[model samples]
Target: MVQILLSLSIFFTSAAQAAEKAGMPQLDPTTWFPQVFWLLITFGFLYLIVEKIVFPRLSDSIEQRNDHVSDNIDEANSIKDQAEKKYQEYLSLISNSKKEAQDLINANKQSLQSNFDNKKKEIDKKLEEKMKEVSKEIDDFKKSAAGKIGSISTEVAKELVKTVSKIDTNNASASSIVEEVSKKYLKGLN
Candidate 1:
């Protein structure tokens, strides 16, 4: 459309100039040759400018844009690979840390269990010794109590015999006195 308008304007200007000049007269307006000639010349010049200057610069700009896009894509891919590698490394580190923690916990648990077992055994041994000591003390107490009871009974029997003898002095005879003397002598010997 621009080409057509420019050709018409050129033809009109050329016709007006020819008309003003007396040497060269204006051509017939009824013929289409002048319009056609001007249209061809303008179009030919536009084609040459576009092919030689405009199109080559546009192609260079397009190629530069494509190269920039390709470089950016490649850089993005490298960054993504690096990120993946770092993530994998972090995961491996975490996994190893967890494994080490589990091992430490297990070792501590075993150590604690062994310590508790040892303490329990010591407590049991001490308890057994305490029980034996208590049993020995009880046996000593029983023996001492039995000896005191026997001494008390013997004193009571002696007091009762002296009272009976004083009450019945006439009935108390010489044979009885001799028998009591012999019993005292036998007890002293034991």
Candidate 2:
């Protein structure tokens, strides 16, 4: 700040001296050549510095930034493509898992159906055997009852004969005739 103030004071002092000596501050024809010469020198110096140093560095910085932006864009595009591939892979995996699960369920269903059929067949076979046993038992009971009925009929016939003839059947000795009559009557029933 102090240097800038000192320079400004010197410039104003020079300008006041020229104004006093030339009687016109800036439009004096006698000083025009020197002012034009200094102006040209300042512009030439500024132009040389800008062309030699500032412009090349500025252009290099701009190209570097552009290259960085381009590389970032390419990387982003590549990552997007990879993400799309991964998404397709994930979808395929889900589809395959569903198909596998369905196949397993179908196999289990078939196995269970076969097992159920086997159990039903076994139950039917057991029921058939039990029915045959019950039928045989019924036939045996019928035969035993027929034999008891024949003996019961003979006793009844002997009692009836004794009652009507007023003779004691125990002394008549005709039990064999009653047994023959009972057998013949039983044969007629068959």
Candidate 3:
């Protein structure tokens, strides 16, 4: 700051000395070479400072800022790619779990169906055997009842004849008559 003030003071004192006899120092032929010499010196000094120091510092700061931004962008892209890959892996895991669950459910369904079919077949076989046993017992009971019914009918016929007709009846004749009637009426039932 002091150097700039001193330079300005010297410039004004020189201009003031030339102004004693001129309309403008810059337009005066006697001061023109000295003014041009000082102007070139100041301009060259400022040009060298900007080119060697100020411009290089500004460019270096700009390059550093640009490199920092580029690195941040690269890191952000890498994180995004990793997130996408994890999402795909999550989707695949869910799909695989669903498939495994479905397979297990289907296997259990088939197992239950097979067990049910086997149990049903076993019950049906047992019921058929029981039905055959009951039917055979019924047939045996009917045959025994039929044999007893003939003798019972003969005795009932002899008593009915003796009481109502007032006559003595024989067992042999009653038996024969019962047998004949039973054969005619009960032939198709057996």
Find the candidate with the highest TM-score and give its number. 3
- Per-residue lDDT of candidate 1, residues 9-98 (tens digit): 999999989777745334556566878899999999999999999999999999999999999999999999999999999999999999
Q: Across residues 33-141, which tens digit of lDDT does each residue of candidate 2 receive?
A: 9988999999999999999999999999999999999999999999999999999999999999999999999999999999999999999999999998998888898
Worst 10 residues of 2 by lDDT: 170-179
TM-score of each: 0.58, 0.59, 0.75
**Clash pairs for candidate 3:** none
Ranking of predictions according to lDDT: 3, 2, 1
lDDT-wise, the better of 1 and 3 is 3
Ranking by TM-score: 3, 2, 1
Q: Write the per-residue lDDT of candidate 3 for residues 1-190, one digit (tens) a residue.
A: 9999999999999988877757765666998888889999999999999999999999999999999999999999999999999999999999999999999999999999999999999999999999999999998998888879999999999999999998888999999999998887688665
| Deviation (Å) of 79 in candidate 1 | 0.9
lDDT of each: 0.80, 0.84, 0.94
Candidate 3 ranges with C-alpha deviation above 4 Å:
1-32, 188-190
